[model samples]
Target: MIKNMKWLLLVSLTFVACNNDDSDTPAEVPVVAGSAVFTKYIALGDSFAAGYSDGALFAKGQSNSYANILSQQFAAAGGGAFTTPLMLDNIGGFSSGGLQVPKFPTRLTFIGATSSPANVPGVSATPITTHLTGTFSNLGVPGAKSFHLIAPGYGNLAGVFATPATANPYFARFASSATTSVLADAVAQTPTFFSLFIGGNDVLGYATNGGVPTSQDPVLGDDITPTATFNFAYNTLVTTLTANGAKGVVANLPYITTLPHFTTVPYNPLTAKSIGKNNDAVGLATIKLLNAQLYGPLKQALTALGAGDRINLLSETSTSPLLIKDETLPNLGAQLAAIFAPTLGAQTAGAYGAIFGQARQAKTTDLILLTTKDAIGTAPTAANSGLGIAPAFPLNAFGISFPLQDKHVLIPTEIAEIKTATDAYNVIIAAAAEAKGLAFVDTRSVLAQLSNGGFRFGNFTMTSSYAVGGAFSLDGVHPSARGYGLIANIFIDAINAKYGSTLRHVDLALYPIQYPLTIQ
Candidate 1:
């Protein structure tokens, strides 16, 4: 009986070993061959699709592009090869006649130990001779507007070099012919799958220009692509792209105002204590004296008009409002001139007119662009030096004697116009996506979440905050490689849900949060 029990125990041990082997090597999850065919994938859009980062486009940036990332995953699932009009070097600027003349500045890099950043030039310039051959897969043009994709001669090299309005230089480099349109080139490929995210530039130009309307006429160009125009163009693109039974995903525009370009600098950055050694009574006394001498009469005039609070006295220990151009302050230059004419004389008063002519306090709704931070306290140009009351004062420096221009600050009215256009465009995008049965990515919601707290992907977290955000690149508008990886995952999720494709998501940690000056 003991021998029988020993044999039974050995049989039990053998059964357990077999079970462990099955658990250790579970059947490989069968790669679900999704409904959509990704044999020939193509991408279409503006700078974001083109992998524009650090204020310029280069080879590394293009390699890590979200479209490229998606294509890699597609390849794993039996997709074909993907190609881009790759720039020659990591140094973003291109060379002309063997001499580098960068149209835009280089990428941003953290200077020393401080959070402050500086624009660093690329390591090498791409020669003009470096051009791609044959039809390419990634057809993203850096600055193409919605209407521009269909506009013929947009890639004409002659027009690009002569008149920017007539053609786009970035497109000119790779265009099949001078008369080829972006949409036509994209369609000629006969793609099995495509990704498009356009229309950002349509409203972005207006917002960046401080809501300065380009033109009321839609055909005039540089203006916000009218809602009707966007709808027509977008629908046509979808119709043409899907005419051959190709599947695609489309992303809507985010609120441009929320970008770090507008959010980095606060509206009220100036405080009496922060400006200089003003924490002491002596410093306070000097500031008061200066205010009384220069801004006293003007303060009284604003008080009479029921805008006394708008007059920012330099004596206050708390934060002071930013100086801005208020068009509603009727005849402001003349009013300020009249106030100073008696003491400073007509010639000096005339100079004051040029100084305080459009000056007003920036409101809570005002957005100070990131680019304006550097110009805040610098001296004015030589021509405008005489505008100061004395050598002790200079009117050219921002906040000192010069008020912020309309271009530097987006006022409340301008903010309203941007919001209106954004909302209208989003509605059109959603409707088109639904009608076409295409995947839609709500980029606005994603950006909003990033701004509110942060976004989490795998083991990493990213925010929309300037340099530290680990999402946006040095430009503060475009995303870093890691950020693009996050975007690729988002697109993958949407694509999977719509097309029934089980595309694998990318690991954000693989891509760097901050791209180095040298391409790795």
Candidate 2:
């Protein structure tokens, strides 16, 4: 089934590429009025449409946004003025309680063959009070989901501090009213053309949070948006936007797990050499001694069950498989505590059980998030030194004693759930585009290309690799300026085919592959 699915996707992508090819050039081509209207273009979606990069929404990133690039091309083909809710400065941030609060770090800079964080302070000079007013064309909110477009009070400033989930700071800075809906605000402009690239955040939140739901309610907060709810909301959005006879383009969701944020780190990062030992025997022996003390008689049982192989003996190694939460493991802790109760006393045995009970070695299928890189070899704080599991031996102090928290790793089961949700959402988006007769952009195929081989645009090549990929910025999830420029050309191909317009594609080489850490 998987092989067949891959073949079908490949064929679909080939069809799209062939359609986009303008090889049979028209000499002295006559101007043609396309079937669709392009007098006013309004883009509506999340961070990608907003041109958010390096983990922040700043002026330079917004200027190079895909929507802005598309609008510029549209102008030559009879489109009108395009505007965005621009940030005050290149150093992106927001304000809280009338004081500047830096939301994201500055853009990354390449220094001497390495990508490092620029020496910029966290605080931004611009406050959220510096608002840009007027019915703007770009309606892309950075963290918006599919349902958020129809949700009222999503832009309420009062809800910013009181109820963050109910309010969006980006929209609050420019929403027409406290109770205004994102969809309603976009519709009020009566746009002649629009582009919708939502649904990424619907499943992205689950992946980014290491597949843990924020609340008990799976449909709310940082869980996957229910498929039924997504269908209803998506259908309504397309229906309302096209009710006035405006033509547009809609992009499908890509697999968020494939991005560098989740793929950069490998699963089996530990080895004998990494532990500063000459042989695997030395490392294995050291880990066995620690395990015997930590688990007692349960140590043999764990080895028999292959748990010993997963435990990294290396101490303070930068690259190591993160010890993670494994609730599926047998109640070895309880059994061990009972076995050692007579000699060690109940309290001491129980302490040992609490420390090693729920912990296990992360598997190859599991993914340790990029954020875990900093905390991997670091020492645990006083509050987290539970029972001093490795008090005698400091080498086992890092991950063996201090297990990586649930938020740092995506277990195999969580990965399966994310894949399921992403597939279901893509189906809904494709069906909606077909029903509305709107041009559909298969972003999944594009992302697959970026992940596997690498996408070539004009004279440059880009991939989903971290830092040096040239496609993604420091944040890993969002695109760099050059990446957005390539995306603009993809949209142009779909638009020209659907509307029968000869819209010229943008020159991607004009955009910079990497933005300097500071404004130069």
Candidate 3:
């Protein structure tokens, strides 16, 4: 800016000279450890700590993790070598050890020309069975919750296959022993200073799975950890970490539902062009067929049953909302069946009742998951077509003719549940940090700012708009490497304020937003 101003006006040259002249630049603030000890430091948390980006936890991503980023800054102080239990290759998920795809899926790559992201055609090279031989400073298990950090057998290799998955594979790969917990290993290092960032996975699961309350994911369990449970686990961690007089920092949980994963897909994305794949004429025909065969009759029957608000007629000019299953709504399938049975046969009426009972058109307040974008106009398979609708009705289309499943959309009721839990968790986290006198990071404010108009970082403005937003990766859930750098800066600021440390924030411009399609 100064250079440009100087060029624009000859009078500004004197001002620029007064400000510059190499030696005139302010002397560098000598980095200091202050009262905080950095000789032995540890980082404990979930994926953000591990630097999971583009939907996978590869070695490069791990290296750029906030923990590692902080360590780099710490190295300028008296901090010692900070080790990471890094993946063997750039392929983020476990590629080899008998792991399966979509579960241990590979990272995503953005195609610039198309402005879209696609899965890297293979699995990660690092397998779950590949155990490390050293203790790591980065104990950021990608899917770990608060309680999981204190749970025994969380790193047991054999337990990874158990129902509900008793162990986290990411931790199992580097845990000290089968019986060791994440805290046990960290405490073993006797860290003089640390950073605690748990509790995200505790609620993220419930939010990401469309606020379904509980998840049956093989790894994270995905259940919204009860407030009491979160409090207990949080205190236990803080109590244990500070027991040895280790001064540390902790972050409060944010309302993670605001992430691109839940916010990107619009509730009303069903348009003629989308339905017809850009062929507006064909799309109009499909829309007409869907309305004539399905939506029109459903609206009439639902209206007669006092549930008219559930279905809205499709239109040709404007975007139409998606059909979603909202379990909170009163099941009106029986009522619909009774209304339709007179015109349609009993068998067909029964199918209609079972299908539309808990279904309703998605509203603006609702959030359609990013993963569901591909499934919008696609047809559901036989197994998913449990509604048992006959061939005569429009039963093939998902999110259109057929209502989306509970896992694909988050309704207002579910959003309320998540907010309640997040607020409760934040309270517990704040209390714990205050009681421990630890540096507190209001991560909620950070993410909220990004979701809202975005906060400035030097010359660039970063937002949470998924791939293009520069803050988040293609997955829409995790942040890009540059985002991690920003987080590292936040941590530095909190530490500097609380501990009187002179730690310098990393320059975010050096970080890359996304990796190449072919990771070497």
Candidate 4:
């Protein structure tokens, strides 16, 4: 917290220093009568910028996306309309804050809680998830990796849009089946100012898998997109954006683990039966180290297996090892490592036992190794029970419930890795924007401020409160509508500063976050 304060102070100093007494305002871009006027804007990226959350996509949520909000201001400043594929849902009402909701249900415990895990009253039956199509100004696909944007038939990917059926309800509304992906559609539009927010999902998939480097196919290797692929796609995306006389901004990925989503559910050692609560914090630290070690070895094993073989392994284990079939687990570590270098076995199994021990003390038991069946379904017919991670309940043994606090913060080493990746991505973005002479907004710092320092939105002062506050949705990572609007202002400020555009800032007063202060 002190470090953040120091950083904020530095930023304030820089801002003051940069804006000396000389107040020579720059000239604005001349406007004419509806001349397809630009700054022609196009937005491309993943979910956060896409505005995906809260059971529906509507005017408020759509308008909250930085891209859409910026486009509105840009249009007002003589830019063109920023068209995005809209995803809408029907209206519904529900009651929350009741006794039955069951207090926040730890972390992984929510797996079998219900489809609508919010624990609010009534059934949530509106179309919750959706996809985009046609000429969408917002190319931010919810689960898209950098490469997924250009992948053929990406619209059909089950993971991209969450719903019971294969096709997204929103996509089903407008698109029968898209011939071209959203990226291609945007490129064909010949935009003048394009914004790219891609590459987040690239590392996100790996992180979500608990940093497992495993893949789906036995023939294909390393399911996660490598650092190389991320760079290449980012460069190509920028190249295409600039090819059509478009000049614009691109955002770099955030340290995913820092967000409340990953950090909430404190690692309580007592829960795992390794240590008392007094030593929980220390144990948590140890677990983080072990996770990095495990992730490194997993990556090496995948690389040796080759792409085809790796993909097969991935099919068996994506998020939890329990999902993998027993037959598949036997083939998992060896066949791939054998193809690459069987010597990799040295890093397997008890490779980081000490670290695991420490983590055990900390209560982060997601790493505890149980047989695939034990992890997946109920207590292996009771013959093999009372083992694996503590609190080995009948439900968890059956894979019916998710483990609480299963996720954790990025350890120092992991944080370093993330920073390196973020730095590389940011440098490329900075260079591209500089080359095109476009406004390069530093969104990372702005996000850090919001996440750390509470920001005011009219009557309500929205703050990032781990899991409780309305600022962030249930996921604890993504922002609520008001949170996104706060972000939109950062983009708006950059546009105003660079292009001498005087677009109106969003009215914080209009959208007040609901924070009812109840007397306990």
* Top of the candidates by TM-score: 3
The Cα error of candidate 2 at residue 285, in Å, is 11
Q: Rank the candidates by lDDT, best first.
A: 3, 1, 2, 4
Candidate 1 lDDT, 1-520, residue by residue in tens: 9999999999999889888857677676554438778889999988889998878788888888999999998987778999899887776756677656555445567656756676665444665434455888888888777778787888776775553247776777788888988889989989988999998888777777666666522222446777888888888888889999998899988998999988988888776554544465654564576577656666776666566766667646666677777655655667666766898898778777666666777777889888778767665555433343422463435654467767677888777778888899889889888988889999998999989988886666799998888888877788888888878988998988997878888888888877775556
What's the TM-score of every candidate structure?
0.88, 0.84, 0.93, 0.58
| lDDT per residue as tens, model 4, 1-520 | 9999999999998898678665456555453312223656777776777775443343345556767777776766577667756533211211123221121111111224343233223322323333344456676655556765655454553423433323223333233254455567677778877777776555555454444455522111224556676667777777777786666766655666555555553432122112112364553443343334443344455445442222111111122222111111223434443433444344433322211112211223223221121133333333332224333222232322221122222234444555677677777767766766666678677557556866765456666664345466545556666666666777666655666656667775554342111101
Alpha-carbon RMSD of each model: 4.8, 9.5, 5.4, 14.6
lDDT for predicted candidate 2 compared with the true structure: 0.75
Quote the positional error of residue 132 for candidate 1 in Å: 2.6
lDDT of 1 at 285: 61
Top lDDT: which candidate number?
A: 3
lDDT of 2 by residue, 42-83 (tens): 999989999988887888999999999999888877788998
Residue 209 lDDT (model 2): 81
How much is the lDDT of residue 270 in candidate 1? 70
In model 1, the Cα lDDT at residue 405 comes to 67
Which of candidates 3 and 4 reaches a greater lDDT? 3
**Model 1 Cα displacement at 361 (Å)?**
1.8
Ranking by TM-score: 3, 1, 2, 4
Q: Model 1: residues >4 Å from true position, as ranges?
A: 1-29, 111-115, 122-124, 128-130, 213-222, 272-274, 277-286, 382-394
